[model samples]
Target: MIGMGNPRGIAGRPLRVLFLVENAPVPGDRRVWNEALTLAQVGFQVSIVCPKWGYPGFYEERQGIRIYRVPLPSLGGIAGHLVEYLIATPVLFLYTALIFLRDGFDVIHAANPPDFLFTIGRVFKWLGKKFVFDQHDVVPEACASRWSGIRMRLTYAIASWTEHASYRTADIVIVPNESVRRLAVERGGIDPARAFVVRNAIGLAHFRDAQPRAELRRGRRHLVFYAGVIGPDDGLDQLMLAARHIVAKRGRQDIHFAVLGDGDCAPQVKQMSQRLGLGDVVEFTGWVKDDRLIADYLATADVCVVPDPKTPVNDLCSMNKMVEYMAMGKPVVAFDLKEAQETGGGAALYVTADGHAGPEAFGDGILELLSSPGMRESMGRIGRQRFNEFLAWEHQQASLLRAYQTLLGYPSVLVA
Candidate 1:
C-alpha cells in the first residue's frame, strides 16, 4: 500500500489548493478529479472552479473537495471559441475572486485547453499564491489542426502567445507526458526544473474485476469500441469511413462498433455515419457518466480503437482513451502516434496510413485484431501488465505528489 502521510504547509496548516478548469466540469474531468482526490486524501484542502456543464448547483462539496461551478456558454468554431473565451475569462476571474475571499488558497492549479487561465494565475500570483499550469493540450497545434486559412493562423498566433504566457506565469508546470514536457521547455522556453510530467492515468480500483455484458454487443458476433471526445481533430470522421469500409467494402456485418463520449463534432460525425450508411453498424452512446455502464461497454468489446488521426496536436499529446483502454485489459488499434506508442509500447497494433488513406489502414488494423483472438488475448495481457507496472494511477500519483512536495517545500521522499 502507498502511503502519503499528513502533508502540511510551512505554517503547520493544510495547504489549500484551488484548481482552475475551463474545458470541462468538475468530477466529469477525470484527471482533475483524480488529482483533487489524491491531494485531498493526503490532507490538502482542495477546491475547484469550473463550468457547471448541466450540473445544477453553483457551489457544492463532493468527496471532501469543494467545487465552484459557473454557467459558461458552449460555443463552437474559431470565432465562437474566441467570443466564448472572452466571455468566460472574466466570469472565471470573478469566481476565483469569490473563492479566494470565501475559502482562501495557497496555490492555483490551472488546467488548460484555452490556455488563457494563465491570466487568472498571474492575478493570483500577484496576491501571493503560487501557480501550477497543467498543460493538457498543445494549444497552437490544436488550433492548427481544427481550423485553417487566415482565421486559423490568427488563432494559432494567439494560442502560441497564451501558451507562452502560461509557461512564464506558472511557478511549476505539470504536463500529461514527456512529449509535452519537452515542448514546455523547448517551445514555451520554460526552465526544465519547473516542469513535471504527471501523466493521464486512473486508479485500478475503477477497473478492478469489471464484468462484460453480452447484451452490450447488441447481438453482434464481434464488438468494436471507441471512447473519448468526438471532436473534429479526434478522427471520428475517419472512424466513420472505416466503418463504411468494414461493412460496405468488405461485406462484414458481424461486427458492431460502439462510440462513447460527446464533443463539438458529435452531430456532424453522427450525420456522416448516416450518410455513409453505417447506421446499423455504429452506435453513439453520447458521454456515459455511469462508471459501471462505461466499464460494461469497455469490458464487452473484442477490440478497442483509438481513431485519433495523426495531427500536429494528436502526435504530441497522450490520449486519455488509449490509457483507459489499456487499463481495461483491452487490445488497441491506433494510428502510429509518437505518444501512443510510448504509452502502448508492445500492447497496441499501430497502423500507418499514407496521405489521406488513413481510414482504410485503420480499418485493416481493426479487422486484423478482430480476426485473431489469440493475438487480441496476448495484447490484452500485455496491456494490463503494462498498466499495472507503469501506467496505472498508483504509479503516476507518486510523480504528482512529488511535484507538490517540491512546490510546497516538503521533504522529498519516494511516494511508493
Candidate 2:
C-alpha cells in the first residue's frame, strides 16, 4: 500500500490527544499539522495549541481538528527569545488549564525546541495524563550552533538541563532520527525502548499529479532552488558565496539562483548577494507561504540545494527540504552530513564538509548536475522511488501509530 490512514478505533474509546508546539503556526507547520491529521484519522479527538506567527485568530477549526493559537512575540536576540518563551508559557498554561477544565486530554504530545514544557507535562501527568516528548531539535546542540564563547556555554547548560527534564518527564520520547533517539537514550538517560524514531517525511498526496511549471525557470539555462529558514546554521551565507563563485568567478551568467524562504539573516543575505556583484543573478523570495509558488519553485528547478553547513544540531537533524525535494522527484546538492546523507541517499550530490571547501564543492556539484539532464533525471527517479518505498509520511505514520499504541499500552487487537 502507498499510504495508511489511522484506523478508526483504538482499544475501547477514541483516544484524545493534546498537541503543543512553541514555534510556528498550525497548518503552516507541516509536520505538526500532518501528525494532527494522522491522529485524527485514527479516531483521536485532536486539539493543537500553537503560537500564531502573525496569523489571524486565537482559535479556529480545520479539517476536524481544534486549533488554538496564542500571540507570538517579535523575535530578537537571546534575551528576546527568552522573553518570548516566558511570555508564551503563561498563555499556553492558561489555555491548557481551560482545556483540562472543560475536557481533559489522555495524552499530552509536546514538540520541543524550547524544552521547558515538560513542567506542564509533569503537572498534567500528576492527573494521569500521559506525556509524550516529541524531540524536534536537540536544544543543547542547537544553542551551541547558534552562538559561541561563554554565552554559548550558558545556553548549552540551560538547554541541557531543560532537555533532561523533558526526557525525564516523558512517558515516551518521539524523535525524528536514530541519532536523536540515541541521544535521548545516551545523553538524556531515556529508556531505549521508550524512544521512537518517526522520520520527517513528505505527505505524498500533496505532490500527486503535480505538474512542472517551466515558466518558473525564468529564461535561465539552469534554476537552482533553495527553500527554508535563512538562519546562521542554515548556511545562506555559504550559498550566496557559492552563487558568487559560480557567476562572478566562474563566469556562469547563464544560471540563475532562486533562493526561496526567509529568516533573521534574509536581509543580510540579500545585501551579501548584491555586494558579491551577483546582480540580477540571484532572486530572494522572502518567506513564501503560497503553495503554488513553492510547488513551482520545486518543479522548475534542475536541482535543489540543502545548504546547511554541518553543525551538531544540523548533522543529526534530518532536513524537511531534502525529503521534500526527493518527493518532488528533484535531485539535491547538500553538505555531506550524517543524517542528510542518510536521508537523501543517492538522490543528492554531497560536498565534503570542510567549511569553505564545502560551498565550493556544492557550487561545483550544481554545475556538474546541471550539465547532465540524464543524470539529474536518473537521480530524481532514484529519489522518488526511495521516498515511496520508505521515506513518505504514509510509511512514517505507521511508526507514529505504533508509538501511540505502545504508549497507550493497547493490546494487539487494538493495533492499527
Candidate 3:
C-alpha cells in the first residue's frame, strides 16, 4: 500500500508530476523553475528532466523538487538544433521513465520548442497518464522567424504537424496568453475550454529585496536596459542601431545601455555594438543568472526596452521580460505588438513599426521617456501597482491551481 503524499499513492493521496522541458534547464528557465517549485510547495511530488546545456549531467534536489540534467551537444544553425533535439528526446524519455519508477507521476507536463514530446506523452498516456502541453511559443512560427531556406520548409511543415498533434493529444493545453489559447483552439483544433491561459508572471520572491547598484548606472543621466534572450528575431541589432542613433547621430552621450541575457546572437550583437561606436556607452552582460544582480540592474535603470520587433512568433508570444520589467517597477518601450500592448498595459510606450519599427523610432521613444522624469515615474508606478493587483504571480498561481484541479478532476484545489 502506498503512503499518503507518495507519488504512487492510494486514494486521497497527493498528486505527482513529471515535467519535461527542452529549451533550457530548470531554475535557469524561471517560468519552469517557478512552476516546479510552486507545485512542490503545494504538496505535489515534482520531478523535472532537462538538458544540461553545458553543465555536467547530475541529479540534484532544489526546493523539494528533483531535477535530472542530461548533457547536450553545443551546436549552431538549423542542423544543430535538430541534432540536439534528436539526442535529447531519447535522453528525456529514458530519464523520465526512470524518474517515474523511482518517484511515480500521475501527469506529464511537457514544455516545447521541439513539439516532439507528444509522442512520448502519447506512450505514457497509453499507460494511463495525463498529458499537458505547455505552450511557450508556436514552434512553426518561431522556426520561420529564425531561419529561411528550402531545407527549413520540410522542418516547418513537420513542426506545424507536430504542434497540432501535441495539442490534439494533450488532456489540457496551457498557454501564456489569449492569443496562444486562441491558436490552440482555432488552429490546433483543441476544445476551447480544455485550453487554459496562465500568463507569464514574475515570482516576487525572485526579486523581493533587490536594490539599485549605482555602478550599473555608470554615472549616466539615463540608463536603458534590455533583458531576455539575444536571439536573431529579438532585434538587439535594432537596439544597437538605436544606441548608435542616440550616441553617434543624436549626440546624447549621457544615456547608458545595459544589454543583459544571452543567446547564439550575443557575439554578433556585441560586435555590431562595437562597430557602431556604442563601445563606451553600451555594456553587454551576457546571461546573468543571479536574480538579485539582474534585479539590481533593473532597479538602477531609468527605462527598459523590449527590442523584439513584429514577427510571426513574437506577435502571439507573451514575453516574460516585459512583465518582469514591470514587476520591478520599471517602465518599458517596445514595438507596437498586440500581446505586448496588452501585457504592458500603460507601462510601455509603443514605437510604431511602419516597416519593422526601425531604430530611429525606438531611439526617439527612449529619448522621450528619458527627457520626462515624471512620465517615467508615473508609468513605473502604474506598472508596479497593476502587477501587484493583477499581473503578479499570485493571480497566475490561482489560475494555475484552477487549471490543475480541473485537469485532475478535483472538486476544488486545496491551498497548502
Candidate 4:
C-alpha cells in the first residue's frame, strides 16, 4: 500500500523539475545522480544546476537529464569556505533566476544549504513554481563538527535562521531520516505533516551487474573493508587504532584492511596509520573512480565496517555504505546509533557504547564475525534480504516523489 500522499493524478506527463546542488560536480554524487535519473525515468524534464570541477568540464546532458555547471573557484579552510559559499550563493541565484525565466518549470527542488535554499525557493515561488527541500545534512550539527570560535557561532546563527526560512518557504522538506524530519518540524518550524522522510538507499541494480573482482585483497587471509570519506567524522583513526590492536595485541598478521575514498583528512589519516606501525596491514586507495572496484571492495570483504563516531549528526544520519555493503551480501560492524541500529538491525554486530568499544572493541567485533562464518552468512543474508524487501532505491522513490508532489499540492504514493 502506498502511504498518505501518493501521486495518482501526475503520471505519464513529463513534469519539469530543476534540481540545485552545491560543491559537487554533476553525475559524480550518487545520491543526487540517483534522484536525477529516477525523476527522468518517471517522465520528468529534469535540469540540474551544479558546480563544474575536475575533468568533466562544463555541461553534458547525460541519461536524458540537462546539466548546467557554473564556474566557481575552489577554496579551502574556514575563510576559503566562507568565500566559496559567498561566491556560490549569488551565482546560484543569478543562474537559477535565468533558468526560471527561460524554462517554464513545474517545480524547483534544491538540496540543503549552509539548509538555506529558501532564497532560491522564494525566487521559484515568484515564478509560480513549487519548491522541495532535499535535506541531506543537518547544518546545525555539522556546524558543531566543523567550527569552534565566536565567529563560527555567529555564522551558525545565520545558517540556522536561513534553515528556518528554507523550511518555511518550501512546500515540503524532504529529509534523509525520520530524525531529520522531526528536527525540521521541531527546530525549523515546519509542519510535521509536510515533512517527508526519504532514506539514503542503495541502487541494487548497480550491484547486481557489478561483479566483485577481489584483486585488491590479492590472496589475503581476511579482508576488512572501510569505504567512504577519510574525514574526522568518519572515525578512520578509530578504525586504525582497532587495526593496530588487532595486529599487536591479537597477533593477527593474516588480516588486510583496505580504506577506500578520499576527503580533507587523508594526509592526517595516513600519518596516523604510519605512526601506529600499521603501514603493512593498512592500504588507502584515495578516491576511486572505478565502480567495479567499489563493488569488489565491499563484496570481497569478510566483514565491512561503518566507524562513524557517536555524535548527534551520526545518530541522526544514515550512512549509505551500510546498505550498499548489505546489498553486496556482506555482514557489517558499526558503532551504535539509532539509525544504524534500526537499519542494520540484527544484521550487524554492534559494539557496546561503554569504554570497551574502542580500537580493541572494533578489533573484537571483526574477530567475532570472522570466527563464525555461519553467523556472518546469517547476518549477510538478513541484510541482503532487508535491502531487497525494504531499503532498495525503488522503495525510496515514492517518498521522494511524494515530497515533491505534496509541495505542488499534487497527490503521491508511499512505496509499499
Compute each candidate's TM-score over C-alphas: 0.97, 0.94, 0.94, 0.90
| Deviation in Å, model 4, residue 96 alpha carbon | 1.5
Models, CA RMSD each:
1.6, 2.5, 3.1, 3.2
Clashing pairs in 4: 3-414, 5-412, 6-411, 6-412, 6-413, 7-411, 7-412, 7-413
Question: Model 3, stretches more than 4 Å misplaced?
Answer: 1-13, 54-57, 149-152, 413-416
Best by TM-score: 1
lDDT of 3 by residue, 323-374 (tens): 8999988989999888999898899999986664478899989999998899
Give candidate 3's error at residue 107 in angstroms: 0.9
lDDT of each: 0.88, 0.85, 0.84, 0.80
* CA shift of 331, model 4, Å: 0.8
Clashes of 4: 8
Residue 213, model 4: lDDT of: 55
RMSD in Å for model 4: 3.2
Candidate 3, residue 177: how far the Cα is off, in Å? 0.2
Candidate 1: tens digits of C-alpha lDDT, residues 164-222:
99989988999999999999999988888778898898888786666889888888999
Can you list the residue pairs that collide in candidate 1?
A: none
**Per-residue alpha-carbon lDDT of candidate 4 for residues 181-266, written as tens digits (9 for 90 to 100):** 88989998888879988888867687655655556665677999988877657889889988999999999988899988877688
